[model samples]
Target chain A: MPTVTLSLGKDSYDVHVMNGALDRLGDLVHRSRLTGHAAIVTDTTVVRHYGERARLALEEAGYTTSLHVVDAGEQSKSLATVETLASELVKAGVDRSGFIVALGGGVVGDLAGFTASIHYRGIPFVQVPTTIMAQVDSSVGGKTAVNIPAGKNLVGSFHQPRLVVVDPLTLTTLPARVIREGMAEMVKHAAIRDAAMLYDIRALAEETELGFTLSTIERLPDLIARNIAIKARVVEEDEKETKDVRAFLNFGHTLGHGIEAAVPYGELLHGEVVSLGMRAALFLSEKYAGLSAHASEDVLSTLKALELPLVLPEGIDPATALEKTLTDKKFQAGMIRFVLLGALGQPTISDDITIDDLKEALALLQRPA
Target chain B: MPTVTLSLGKDSYDVHVMNGALDRLGDLVHRSRLTGHAAIVTDTTVVRHYGERARLALEEAGYTTSLHVVDAGEQSKSLATVETLASELVKAGVDRSGFIVALGGGVVGDLAGFTASIHYRGIPFVQVPTTIMAQVDSSVGGKTAVNIPAGKNLVGSFHQPRLVVVDPLTLTTLPARVIREGMAEMVKHAAIRDAAMLYDIRALAEETELGFTLSTIERLPDLIARNIAIKARVVEEDEKETKDVRAFLNFGHTLGHGIEAAVPYGELLHGEVVSLGMRAALFLSEKYAGLSAHASEDVLSTLKALELPLVLPEGIDPATALEKTLTDKKFQAGMIRFVLLGALGQPTISDDITIDDLKEALALLQRPA
Candidate 1:
């Protein structure tokens, strides 16, 4: 697959989506002019699979490498984990000139990227995303964060990565559920920015087992790059998420995050909750934004084809989800700025999303239509 | 007495230096176009003195306000304080559009600024620095951090404040020792960028008791602004401190921070150690940078006039101080980027200064002369 460049002027970087890019991680970092120590932050599970391969690749490229692993779960995304990682980085002699290699899924990317953002008031980092969620979405933008008891991603920074290497080959090792989680975001990208990509996604889902079959891995790079490109374009327009255009990316996140918070984290994967959120949003978009039912169904059909969840998991009260939205970062100055679609590929940010509208949409999720 | 505008394009803001700016805090924030809740993060000591004045002023301007106070001291400048303060801001219903008011000395400013930077992934903050050390130095730069056990300012960000309010009247309530601590940075500014300001500083010390006498309060606004402008200009030139020019501000800080770490914090004030460090820097300047003896003495005489310490406190081993420099942030990538003076106003950042040179500078601190 071709490399997609995120045009952030001086902070601009390239996102390389290819079959074997991970093997060239050191070459990529060297090309970006990143020198000094390279601390690879990953997870125990990911380390067992590809850690030694990544270390050898960096060492072969004439870079000193150190592997720092954490427990493989959302529980590791905390201040304590970040503190421990930072101390380990310092112990490894990582300094202002040193850079971090976030070599795992979204959890590793967010944890390590955030660690790099605050260590010595921030240093450059490279993202070697090993999961579909990271390769397509989290890795492209610089929204690094960790969860606190108060909330998820409550503590974070907009520290962009210096380079991103996405190797689709890693997908073969992921669980089927993880692949579906990333597919949910891919469907979101197609729904909001690239309408035609929905057809491609439908075709890809039919051809491969969640886009991870060895025969399908050959096609995974282009599919992942297209999704990443959509994320990059959105980030380039609003690097800090200050502009409302960035809200389009959060079409499902407002309710998705709320419902995700309603459960013990990890009970439902992030993509599963987002899938449910997208379904609710489609219902609201048709009613509140005059979105054509045809466009809405097109998105829902693609989500269904990918086997993404459309119904909320059992035991999650709609009222609890609604209540959680109140404390969400989306609530700006006591106003809910909801993103809706007037048409496929055309998003509108509306403040007209009343609590009644949300309740009605969430109720629609229970019917499983 | 005038406002100093830090020109950083869109991030530019005004630093108001006036006799009673605290009373007009509401008008200033209102003028800046910041709306929503104002969470004033302060210390226990400061809240007792002027917290009500600040709260009432914002309230009178039709803004909702909350007071969040922590214990007063360097100990409060920790990640724990930042976390507790963050939780308080969240409980106060502070959201994305909400702002933070850092209302105290360096500890308060650093802790609050860092808290604001990470809350909701970054929020605007106003620096209401009440100490000369804060008003003339820390408050002007966007350098915010919370110390970890590994090191000081080990975890932080470059999140600049949207506005800064420096009321010289607040200085009158400060102890003479606190007032002298700020003089160390002021002397640093004059020694680096404005040689003539040294004379003004000496004259100011002569007029009132260390520039905090009620009669001398009127003279403080301009003095503080001048020092802040120097800091502001340097920051504009190197917003991230990546450029060599910003290193000039570290003229005495390298050795100063080393010696400060040599003692249990608060035993010798930051400025007292800096005063000693400045003397040692002068000795190095004469030896390594062709600085004239007369030029060095002229600045030394001004520090003496302010009654800032010229001798290292007994019991602080020079070897320990030198050892501490190895871990100081100034030791960039294994080289000491030492700042020295060729003349009173001519400063240079040099990597040529060896560990032996640091030993010599530390030795100079052992002598009272």
Candidate 2:
């Protein structure tokens, strides 16, 4: 197991990147002695694909396993769903001593982890993430939340999982678009913190073996591991986002979340918005952070070659999308803190980013109707 | 200002026991500098009594204050209420940078604490306890939760407050019944951890000074502080109750929660059931822990003199009440773990109590109605 140890004192845990890692979840859980009763929470689509495998792994490890399924989109990441899942867990005899396994993508992970966080004033939970977005991004962080009607992740808690089992093999079944969209996060990781990693990822994107399909990429496990390591380092430095360092991880999320919220929640994938957000950030970087024209060109070319959309999809109004950013959790006192690229790898936080700057940046992402 | 420090490392905080602590809550909250946006979560009844006072204090402290009121009683402690409050907080423009104040007794404290634990994955919160029960017990622990239709506190999280402001002045307006019901917990605390405290409480019970009216208590702040200290010692030893030391604090809660839930939720004040629960535990103590008959009589006399209940209410069934204990959160791997008293001041954990013993003990609490 190539594990990335994310240390947050008592809340620390390992993010294990191993092929077929889901099969070994039983061993990891048993080693930790988390619980004999396991509640596996997954989305409807994921349950059909990985449910039995997950159940078998835990049951063989002497766990009394039960499956709880939610719908397979962002809408399922909600309080009502959490309430229903909790009631089902109670019915399945999952007590305070029982451990919860979030066995899918970010939606399932967020909802299940949030459920476990409050199920009995908190219980042990593990993230068996199946998507690249979740593996390298959401799973390693202790941030768990559900979308309220007012905003995304408006209500939740800082409950860390006991362990994270990242099995890249699970992503093999995902559609190509989902996989490609998830890579946007990896791109953002490189842009914000690691210049060398960005060049490396761009080089890999030029290689023939790096086809968009999961079957074509044997190099993904290593790529994902590097991204997780970068994220793990940042999270270890600031788990609760109190020191503004963790705010670095929210590099593209300000406008990214805004765009995601502006459209129908499930319309454009989360990473797609971030991809558009990154493209817009490059414009902001040039205008505000003294990013070079040559460097911005290189970044745009890399994103284009990787097939990530560089602008908002048709029908999205730039102004409406800009309005959505106002409610961003990043808004403090009254100003929205924007994280812009100072250079290729240097991300800078600016509280002085006016709404006019946001509009100007979003204009670059507006596709003609 | 008299302060009792309840230290649990990162979770530790001071319990300020002052005669007019509520008036200075702004100073304490501001001193900690937890957050500037204050969302005060109180009940309708509470807001009417101290709502203006609370609002003025925080407002004067320069906090942007928003008041969210829930109807009084146990029913208000639900996920629906949490959802509504969260939405209200959002509407009030509370961001993660805000702090929350829980300004009521057990119901408001539990609901508000729970709201804080999950709202924006938790923000800083302060507890301004108004009732004797909350001051002596619930407000000290970080256990925040809501009632699911399945059970009381079946869903929650462990989010400790930055400060617990206990103003004895708030108790002056509490109904006499609420005050007596509260004494049950103080009696239970004395019985389990401190014999001298128990004797002192017994002496207090015999005095004319211990009247059913709230205005009669001239020496309550010290008595309340002593009980909080006993609880503080137990909670410090085990913040999450993993080591079972804190479970000792639940000496009478096994059957107590059952009685509360089996009847109408609002019908039995929590401490009233716990009072009867303490009476039943004494019977079990005699049969299983070799507790002296004289000691049991002394405990009973103390409870009776304090106006706490010794038997189940007129309508609750003995069998139904016993069944509710089966779902106790203290149950691990299907066995209900009971905290019983070995003597007046010796509380110990017991896993060997059979159903026969529980039935026999509970039978003692049956009224002849």
Candidate 3:
């Protein structure tokens, strides 16, 4: 087991990575001292798959449990869904002393954690993330939010979970496309902070099957642990994202958020949009940020091999996407800031890009053979 | 001038008590390093009184200022009001870097602060509290919240203000009832933690016209400063109310909340209900928690002399009020916890009171001569 501790003073919690951390969740909850009735907020699909196991674990650990499942999709990550879940918790009389467990993908985790943050001004919650995207990124950080009509994560709170149980075994059941999508975020993490991890990810992408077998899962644990640690370290230093150190984590997110906003939410996964965004950021990095040309090519090749989208979707206007970038939370004083790759293992924020510059870069990426 | 520092690690801020802190708000905003556009969130009544002064101060501070005034009342503390203010801020293109100034009583402060917390996932806000309720208590603690139909402060965050600029001069125009209502919170602060402050408040209450005079106004700075310090120390040590240490601050709030919920919200000021609630809690503390009879009597005498309503309103059934107690956020598991005064300077949380016991205590406070 590889353990990562998010040392956020008194709010610190541990992220445990192992093969069957799900079954050991009762022990984790016990150790965290969260008692009373445990409410598990998940989705219908997740409940069908691993809900019984999760409930059994909590029951065995001497907790009275209840399950509340929403429809599984990106639509569930909305204010309406959060209000419904909070209302259910209130009707069921989940008080300050009760424990709320968010046991699903990023959508469920975000909505459930946000509900926990606002319910009774906040209560304790744990994360049992089953999706690879969640295990690698969203579950480790304390950023919980719901999508608004204006944008994704427009309303939310920075409420950390009491414990995060990342079981590699859960990902064995994920679809190939989902696995490919999850790899995009891991790849972005590597390209921005760790070149060696990027190399390892590239090597993994060359394999016939993306999901690792039992023997190869050892390599998988360290990579996931390392990426999560980088994020945790950044969050520890700047939990509120006020400083530049934490902003580096947004290396691909500037364009990624725009792409995600442009595309119908459920049509493409977050990591897929992010993968394509990384390519655009790399192009801008080379053109405007003075990044090495070879390193940008390496990032492109690695993403291509993983079957992740490096090009913008068909019929979407680059100008429309660029317009969306202006409203981004990171944009300040009429300047749209971009986190561009300085090298394979480094990134920098740049504000010197013009609309013409972005159009030229988009043409380079979308050029016909 | 008296200044008290509320230290919560990185969220630390100063509560500046002076005669003209309102006029000097620009200097304070500059010193606090707040840049970008300033959106001042106040109510129509406060705007009619001091809004121009606040806007001028922000404008002089080199900020592009916008004023948003909502209808003034406790009803304005709803989610709809919060959304309205949030919409205006967004329409004005307020970004994460922009600063929000909450420039009214608890209603405006709570609504504005809650909106700021949810806006862009969190932004910095400063509190320029004009009311006595805001100056002494609400503005000092980082407990920013908006009321939901289910409960007060149901949706909120512990988002600390960058600075709290309290001008005692602002109180010169306040209604006598409003001042009395504000003093209830100040007296509660003293009753729970500081006997010396409680004695000082008792001395003031015994004076003619309840001590509202120029000399008394001169003494306002120290009184407000001391009350803020008491709250700051408690909130600093326990930012999130995980322990009994922070619960002490809710000394009169348990029953006060029940009263607020039971009565029409705007019918009685929060302090009036709190005064009645404190008397009920004192009665329960003496009978159930073994609180010293002499100490409880002294406390009751001081509250009575202040002309605070120690008696519950007519036609209110103790049993019905006890029912509201169960829904309080402070209640955990099957127990409804009450913050009781063990003595003038000592407060403790008690869970021993049954519905019948609470009913009996309520009856004691409600019985007419």
The numbered model that scores best in DockQ is 2
**Model 2, range A344-366, lDDT digits (tens) per residue?**
77888887688888888888777
Candidate 2: segments with Cα more than 4 A from true spot: A199-215, A367-369, B199-215, B367-369
Model 1 whole-model lDDT (C-alpha atoms): 0.88
Clash statistics: count for each candidate: 0, 3, 0
Residues B90-115, candidate 3: write the lDDT tens digits.
77878787979999999989888887
In CAPRI terms, model 1 is classed as medium
Residue lDDT tens for model 1, B142-255: 999988777888889998999999998987778887887788899999999999999999888787563446657767888888999999999999998888988888888899
Q: A48-92 in candidate 1: lDDT tens per residue?
A: 988988998899889899999999999998888887888888888
Model 2: lDDT of residue B209: 42
Best to worst by TM-score, what's the order? 1, 2, 3
- Winning model by lDDT: 1
Tell me each candidate's i-RMS in Å: 1.2, 1.2, 2.1
> For candidate 1, what TM-score does chain B get against the true chain B?
0.98
Runs of candidate 1 with Cα error greater than 4 angstroms are A207-211, B207-214
How much does each candidate deviate from the true structure in C-alpha RMSD? Answer: 1.7, 2.4, 3.1
**Candidate 3 lDDT, A172-191, residue by residue in tens:** 77887887788888887888
Give the winner by TM-score: 1 or 3.
1
Compare candidates 2 and 3 on lDDT and give the better one. 2
